[model samples]
Target chain A: MRFQLTEDQTALRRATRDLLERRFGERERRAAAGGGSLDRALWRTLGDAGFFALCLPERDGGVGLGFPEAVLVFEEAGRALLTGPLIATLRAAGEVPGAASGETVVAAADGWTVEWLAAADVARPDTADAVAVRSVDPLTPLHRVARAARVDPVAVLLTAAEQLGTAVRVCELAVQHARTREQFGRPIGAFQAVQHLCAGLLVRAETARAAVYAAAVTGARTDIAAARLLADEAAVDGARDCLQVHGGMGFTWESEVHLHLKRAWVRAGRGGGGAAAEEALAAALTA
Target chain B: MDLSHTPEDEEFRARLRAWLATALPVLPPPPDPADWPARRARDLGWQRALYDAGYGELHWDASPTTRLIFLEETEAAGAPYVGANFVGLLHAGPTIAAEGTDGQRRRWLPPILRGEEVWCQGFSEPGAGSDLASLRTRARRDGDHYVVDGSKIWTSHAEVADWCELLVRTDPDAPRHRGISWLAMPMDAPGVTVRPLRTLAGSAEFAEVFLDGVRIPVANRVGAENDGWRVTMVTLSFERGTAFVGEVVACRRVLRELAAAARRDGRWDDAVLRRRLGRLNAEFLALWRLTQWNVSEAAAGGGVPGVGGSVFKLRYSHARQDLYDAAADVLGPGALDLDSPWVLDRLSSLSYTIAAGTSQIQRTIVAERMLGLPRGR
Candidate 1:
């Protein structure tokens, strides 16, 4: 009957948000945006904090929380726009011992392909030793590293969760822009046209969040596709609206808005594009 | 985090199932609306049987937990009961129980439980669907009766319903919402007329019911005077929640058929359709889970689903529409050909979004109430 987060979940969310704010603030995000790769330090910090281990079994050196709690954490990650091989690491961490403790990183094989593994700290393709990382969104910390593994539904669900987070953040950024950006001496949010756009973005974000969280809790294949579809739409449309809200500044490299847009574009296409997700959804629905 | 039911509840489910095995009769699928009366009678018969077996009033305080268990089990067993008289069982029953005097409940409850009566909602008029308070239905007091005069549109099952749980303006001087009063009126009462309205699905399931100087007994009133809006809201909320689960399950069955068809035709290889189907499946699962969540919550004595129900309704309507659209796309030219049985059934799925409440209206509800956004108007 209630959708509110439990106290532990709320605290976890707040702590995660605070951690991201402290370690990967706007300046750090900007720095990472201009960087060669994602911030490994932040990834390590998350690993140490058991972020990757949230959904793992208790016996697996993890918190053993359910999808709902994982959703809270992922949402916080999205809000922070923290970039790293976080999803891949988390997915791998669940399968391998000490993976969540920064001892290992696993990468997925599909959607994004991993190449040039010599420089990677560990390269286990389709195995526990290898974390496959794909460059679906090169801007983010995702990679197609060689890893020995089977395609995990949990991984797909987690990736969708991360995408949902990114979409929500994009919507928040768009709303903030609409509220502050002035046109004709009034806040653009006051304009009906702008408000509608922001409102649509908000709907997309909220719906996607709801769908994704529901999927996490239910672990239903159809719910997963719904979460993915909403997340995809939110990320893609939210980014577009953010750009619209930012106007000219959004197109520039200096603007984080463009970065979000870029990441969204990459994520939407990654793991499988809109077409793939849509087709799967159609099948699931009819099924 | 433990979503499992208590052992006692599990045992209850089992015992109820055993009882239903003997008490419940197997029935055919829903007949075409063309055979409206026959189908309606059959449905009523089934409902009466259930009521006789003590499966009617699940949540009423007088109804024991055993009765609730039986009702839940019947639902879980996927036994077809009745269709389209939901306004009575879910809404009228509860409202009368909560607000009606003992005499009123005694009069109405037994007939409803016995399936001797069918009730349709008389809330939305042509002018007021979402802005329900703006309804122009007037029911002025006259002696021991109220002289009702106004028309209610989108009255589902009006032609077949024995009675109506109607909302009308009782006091002209009161505020729009405040002036409303809910009364149960017999469909065959003098000055009452029902005109069928056909939907795109080619079903005359709804009607425009006209009330011209219809004298309704004061004893039919359920809730306080000029507080009909509250009663109507409670009814609508129930409509938005529990009342729709069976329908959703039925829709899911249809969706399954469509999927099987797609698979048989080897259309699963179509990448575009596959992705679309996947997403639809996901949305359906989320909705199904939400429905289960609501049911379990109520079983545990949680509050009415409030904003959560609104969110579910909004998403569900859209998802239902999306499912139909996906089916149409997959069915290709066959989708448009209503002469084909498959196409007709697929086309029927389109009504899900528009029937209970339009998707647009549900979205407005979600935005205004759930998100606290400015009214779109």
Candidate 2:
């Protein structure tokens, strides 16, 4: 009846965090986003490290892991706010020729929008003339894509895992800010208002993390739907509360808080979004 | 992360289920809410049956997974819960097992497992609810006895309890938190009074216990003098940690029944309500999974839940409230009827945010203890 990470899984998670912290810290993330294009070198580096090919068979020139491991890596990527066609490329690892090696950057259409479409080497359901759109999140470049489809459940679950990661990251950011940021001669964390907000954020993130991890394990459609719904809430709401904790500093472009908020907003719309997930869940329950 | 039960655990579950199937039908019906003595007898009888069947002591003696299975299977089978014996079995007994002396264990633990005694919590006072450390219930030491003279509010089952796990300020001069002591007060002692306190739900299941110098033996002290606060925290950890396992299962059952009622009443056709129910279904499912995560985490780390229990409690308290709110939606005007069990549950749900620990306190604990946030004065 264990529901915690095994020693091996914990080591995998730590390694992923270390890699992201070293290669995709705030400075590097902003640097890669400055030109509004995918960083090819970093993408290749991640692929070489088996971030994309984590679930692929060792016989097929890949790391032979599973969804649980993939979820952990993506969670780290989400925390680092690593942007690009990461989810699509990872999904295409085994099927697309160069995706597993990061030689090809794949982008998939999500409703009317697609991320990094211009920088992608291949588009899954080739769109008819994508127009570049100004993205709310600086790290993620988007284009107005003309096609959309009901995404696979695995894609939905992975999107949720990313949201869970963002949720967790923002919670830590909120707690850190609350502890160090002072107001009226004491840490703002000493105040109940800010403390309650930070506490609620942790609760939401943790609840969503449980749902996301369980979705990865169970692979049930209902579980995935619930995970997506909760993860979206956690990420979106957690970022907003984190900004509240940081006060004026959080609103500045230099602070990473806004990036998390924008990314959460963007991710909330991905993989059929909250409305779709809710409807799926509603149908399941009603049926 | 494996969630499957071992074959041995599965056998235990199967045996329990079979025993319950045969055992439940022959038992007398449950007593009314107002019938304290009858309720006590019925509850203790169920406990005794479990004791005789070798399923007693599972709360502390069994592995966490097995305990979880016991809770899940029992709740699923519509079996009687610990009921009036909750404080003794879930709270005091565990505290005693964890912290009591060998003699304390020998004297107290078996009677609790055998369902021969009942205990009520005497922690909350009229002057000290959330700020329990500030309780002014005084206990003065004399020769071999402590003369307790104070009052405790919200002491559940005090009217029928054989014992009361009482907290009193033993040293008025020391720091508020440091001056306390935990003592097991005999409820039948002279100068003790129990005044039934009616809840908002119109039930007098709890009482205001006033002790006008009730004498307790020195041997009844669970832990050292001036260390009651820490001892009380131990009991509270149990309250927050695994106390809600069976309740989570019960909530899931209530959710299913609400959905079925909604369908019967044509409330299922409403998209908004259906979506709400669906969302709640997802919420409870996640909470159940959260319970699994917590229980497993506890099992891995010395069988005591860490701060994660606060996280579970915070969300779960609201979820339980939200669940009853959804039931009201299904019931519509039918919800106004006090006779409905759903209506009664909706009323009972109001206390969850206030009981065990308030949601406000839970947030503070999560922030200060779990997140390492600076504590507020």
- The candidate scoring highest on TM-score is 2
lDDT of 1 by residue, B129-168 (tens): 7677898889988899999999999887788888898999
lDDT of 1 at B27: 58
User: How many residue pairs clash in each candidate at the backbone level?
Assistant: 49, 0
Each candidate structure's TM-score, on Cα atoms with residue i matched to residue i, is 0.84, 0.97
- RMSD (Cα, Å) for all candidates, in order, is 4.6, 1.5
Tell me, by lDDT, which candidate is best.
Answer: 2
lDDT of 1 by residue, A28-58 (tens): 8777666445456676788888888887899
Model 2 DockQ, alpha carbons vs. true complex = 0.71
